[model samples]
Target: MSKSTLKKGILQLLIANVLNMIFSIGTNFLLPKYLSVESYSQIKTYQLYITYVAVLHFGYNDGMYLKFGGRSINEVYNEEIQKNISTLKLFQFIMTICSVCVAFGLHDTALLMAAIAILPQNMIAYFKNFYQAIGEFKKYSRIMNMTTGLTFAINLFLIAVIRTDRYQVYLVGYIILSVILWFVLEYSLQRIKEFKPFAFDFSLRELYENVASGILLLLGNFSSQLLTGMNRWFVKGLMDTLAFAQYSFAVSMENFLNVAVTPISVTMYNYFCNHDENKDIIRIRELVIAFATVIVATAFPVKFILEIFLQKYLDSVTVIFLLFAAQIFYIIIKSIYVNLYKARKMQKKYFTKLCIIVIVGFAFNVICYAIYHVKESFALGSLLSAIVWFFLCLIDFKELRYSPRHYVYIFIETIVFLACGILLESIMGGILYITITIILSMLLLPDAMKKIWNTGKVMIIRMRKSKSR
Candidate 1:
């Protein structure tokens, strides 16, 4: 991708996510506060289960993503691609049927709903992966905006108009919306002028090839998801719905922080697909880390918001801070190490690293929870595992190397940040944390910080000029 195209794509995604964040403030925050703890817990349970629904595709979409990355969507829409999609659809349908049956047999509503959602969600995943792979981020942004807008509207109506406290309503609405979104995405793809039309040309050979090529990537991606959500899963299984709700609330807050970071990740993957310069990648990594550092300052205001708006979930505040601090490391692991591995086609190593992290993470959670028998330990364990994951990622950068200074910088940043958030426990502490972080950032990441300052100044000038015109 050209530099202009890259900037445009990133800008488009950022604008869309800004809208998403605005809408999500209601759906993610207000809705939970309005609903009863038990009701919200059920909704969170469904959300957790549904996230794993992507695995049903068995990597067909991932294979297409890997094969088509750095290319245009129009360039890759051939009979072979059609055959692969057809075969994958058929496979997904079979899996969905079997999974739904199992869920019904077990008499679990959440599992059944998640199983029913698999087909539509995986189908949408195919389109999303297509857009990301081909650098068609405008379409991706539209889909994101549409999903969040519809969701926020529906949630607001429920909270204000219906005043419904039943989790069933929210759960059913979510599945129905998924189906509708899938149809909309399909219609949009068909209207693309560059494409002829999709056709069902199922081929066993094509199915095998796509699955074989993408399965490792799919596993790696799934494992990464598992690593992130493992704590929530453990809480759900080990505790009551109320506890699960509180923990999920914390997780949700941490997820909202990703609104800004996700666009950078998506755009970076596209950039990496086209560029292999080590210096550029490292510089991007540092800037991204610096941005993550600065963003943590929002946690102070977030704490106050939760305290005033969702007072019932006040117990989750510390967990929220810990997760927020841990997120700094996770962002680097995700936007840097994982993207480079995929772009470089180091699928085997990527899969292996993720699997190791997942296993070690699981073991840590088990040990920590066993000893402390509290939710905080699980959150702490997640932080520790994330630190290990970050360290592991540094060992093999292929062409890039990090000095001892890099390690010390990240280590000190994480420890001091976490300490400030956890130990101080006041808004004033947050100010102190930000002050300390700024000093550390200037000392440790001066180059990245300088670039960010320059970029901010340029943006301000552009904004002023546009307004004057």
Candidate 2:
């Protein structure tokens, strides 16, 4: 795709995700407000398992991502695509059955329901990743918008119209939606005229090759995700359902902020994979960080709102504050560094970095819980892990020739945000943060800020010209 087309695609995704984020914020706030804490916790649990469903593919999708990135879907043979999907379907079928049996053995209805949802959800993920890999971001964004929109609609109907308090009802709605969404994706794929029905004439050799090629990436991605979610796992396992509910609620809040950043991370992967000359790499990185810093300012207001609406889970208040600030660090690693690593085919380094942080995150949680035994420890651990990963990424990012002063600025800015959130009241902290951040950014990183300002103006002009045309 041309640069112009790519920018338009990215812009489309940004707009879609902004809508998704608004709907998601509604769903997030409404669910907790309407449901009992225990019920909300169960919903979060199901969502947690949904994230792990990617592992069920065992790198099949990741391999496709690595292999087909920067290429069009039509470039691959029809038979090859069909065979890959068929093999994946068969493999996932067996895995689902085995998992269902275990769930039955455990006699957990929620586990059983989650196990059943895995197959359809994983299938949907494959198609989603297919579009992402092929740079068909419009298609990808459509899927995202549909999924989020449907989710919000479902949640609204259940909570507002039906007035249902049963988590099972919600779970059933979600599972049915997953199946429907999977079929929708399949239908869209067929309509593309390049895709055909899978024959199920599978190839063990192809499966093995894909798994081999992508296992490191899969491992790295999974580990990175695990590191990100490790604290939740720790809390869910060790604490009461009420505690898990509170912590996961904070995570849900964090997801609201995170959705806005999704467009850049998604678009950057495609861009970096296709383009080698990254002369503006540092500028892009700085711009992303600046965006993230501004994004962090939203946390204070969210926390303030949550204080009024979700009074029962006031335990999550501080956790929300910390996670939101931590996300600045997380965004830097995710949007800039991780994409850079993947685009450069630095799987080994990527895997190593993830492993290191996972270990540190695990230790941080263990030691903190051992010492303080508070839920906030988990959030602190996540922040600590993110900080560690941020620095580690900088260490390896030698090609950018990024100045040490910039590194210090990032460090200081993050600390200032956290300290503001922790030290002052919500409104006061927010005002102070915005003022300090604006001043520091203007004073210390004037050049980068000016570049970002000019780039934004150009992007706006180009978008307006295209629209007029």
Candidate 3:
């Protein structure tokens, strides 16, 4: 793809993500406002159960992603796309059936909601990847934005107008929305340049091949979820529904902020994979560093404001601080690889990182809960894993170089924020530490900022020229 095309795609996706985050946060606040913590926690519970459906995906989709990640619209043919979709539909069908059985066996409304959502959710996810791969960002953004808007609107209608506190309402709304989105997504897919409708082609051989390629990716994803998603179950055991609600609330905020950064990761995966040499990856890192710097610096104030407005969720304040802090290191680790292993077909190294994260992350979280018996400890445990992943990126991807001092600086900065968070233990303390760190980091990141600005300047010039044409 041309630079302008890539830039446009990134911009569209970013806007969709930002708006989606807002809409999600709105429901998060609305739910807790009208309902009891217990009812709201049910929504959180429903969300967690839905994640299990993702676990069922088992990386079949990711294999498609790793395969098509860097290619442009014309590079791939319709037949191949049809085959990937066939594999996706099969896996999703199997998972949905399993979810249905589990939901009925347990006789739980939340599980049932999950079962209903699995297929539609999986389809929505497929289209998101599909549009991105085919360079259809306009459709990509439109469909996702529509879903985000409808979801929030329907949710508001349910809670505020209907005056109901049943978390089941949101689940029902999502199932309906997901169904609509699947049709909309399919329509959008049909509009792809020179796209043609095809039958449901089946290939047992191809399906097995797709699974073989992506199972490790699946394991990595499933294990990662165990660390983050399983925390709700673990936290509930440690405390009550309200406590889990608070932890879940914090995570909602953390994940919301996380949405905005995703376009960077998404685009970077393709950008690096499209190139053989490390030079391009290094250029991209400058932009990554700049973005991370801004996200880390602003995280505290944003969390503080959300905490103020959503005072009932006050328990989440500390959790937000800790999780967002960890995301700084997470971004660093993410930027380092750019999904190079998957792109390079280095499944061993890719699987290795996934294994280490799953093992170390699970061990730390469980051990932390055993000691402190609180969600705070769980948050700390995740940060510890991020620290480990940072180093793993350095060692595993030996294709690049940066200053050793750069590595040490990352460690010290991470430790300092973590120490401040643990020691002072107040919103004000976090803001203060963030202030100090921002000042210190400014001293270190001027070169990165300069590179980012230069890149942005070129992008803007190209975009303007394209517009003039």
* TM-score, per-candidate, Cα-based: 0.95, 0.94, 0.88
For model 3, what is the C-alpha lDDT against the true structure?
0.71
lDDT for each residue of candidate 3 in 1-469, tens digit (9 for 90 to 100): 5556557667878877888777867866776667888888888888888776766677666666666776777777877777777667766878788878988999999889889788878777777776655556666667667876787898889877998877777788878988888877666666763344334666777677767777787666666676566556778776888889999887876776556776666665665555556776666665565466457644455456565766777767667767877787777666457366666777677667767777888788889988987778888888788778777777866667766646655656666665665455357756776676566556666666566568789989999999999
Could you tell me the C-alpha RMSD of candidate 2 in Å? Answer: 2.1
Looking at candidate 1, the ten consecutive residues that score lowest on lDDT are 192-201
Identify the candidate with maximal TM-score: 1
lDDT per residue (tens digit) for residues 383-462 in model 2: 88998988888777777766776777777888888888877777898899999988888977887789778878998998
TM-score for predicted model 2 compared with the true structure: 0.94
Q: Each candidate's root-mean-square deviation in Å?
A: 1.8, 2.1, 3.3
TM-score of 1: 0.95
Each model's lDDT comes to 0.83, 0.84, 0.71
Q: Per-residue lDDT of 232-342 in model 1, one digit per residue for the tens?
A: 989988988878888998888888877888787888788998887888888888888887777766777777776676688888888888888888888888888889999
Decreasing lDDT order of the candidates:
2, 1, 3
How do all the candidates rank in terms of TM-score, highest first?
1, 2, 3
* Backbone-clash count (model 3): 0
Off by over 4 Å in 2: 459-469
- lDDT of residue 306 for candidate 3: 60
